[model samples]
Target: MSTNDDGIEYVYTRFITRNGKRIYHQKGGLYKFPKRSKKSKS
Candidate 1:
């Protein structure tokens, strides 16, 4: 796991299949999706 200058962190998720194989899934990287923020009525 590592973080970039842009404050984006990179992490790997481990998963196992039926065949007993280890797979790493990448989460949170350079290409991060924008999150929607809820607006409050004033």
Candidate 2:
């Protein structure tokens, strides 16, 4: 859940505890997938 100086959206979603546990986490400022490109100009 970090971004480089370039700002190329990314994520690090999930962590496991030392004693065998699953931790769910979400960061802020993350972007969703972009829309599909247009196939036809007309």
Candidate 3:
């Protein structure tokens, strides 16, 4: 979902919840989607 939206489909490992926000996890560390949308603008 977020992975594909954020354009990190391959590198994405999984996602987590912290501070009421979705935190994506990868091999390097973690990150949050720049902006959430029902449909990605790009």
lDDT of 1 by residue, 5-37 (tens): 554544444442335775445552233422233
lDDT tens string, model 2, 1-42?
454444343543444334577655554334432224333333
Determine which window of 10 residues in candidate 2 has minimal summed lDDT.
Answer: 33-42
Q: Decide which is better by TM-score, 1 or 3.
A: 1
CA lDDT, every model vs. true structure = 0.41, 0.43, 0.51
Residues forming the 10-long window of minimal summed lDDT in candidate 1: 28-37
Query: Which parts of model 2 have CA positions greater than 4 angstroms off?
Result: 1-11, 28-42
Give residue 15's error in model 1 in angstroms: 7.5
Write the residue-wise lDDT of candidate 3 on 1-42 in tens digits: 336545443333476666999766565444444444355565
Q: Which candidate model has the greater TM-score, 1 or 2?
A: 1
What ranking emerges by lDDT with the best candidate at the front?
3, 2, 1
Which residue pairs in candidate 2 collide?
1-12
Question: How big is the positional error of residue 32 in model 2, measured in Å on the Cα after superposition?
Answer: 24
Which structure among the candidates has the greatest TM-score? 1
What TM-score does each of the candidates earn? 0.30, 0.23, 0.29
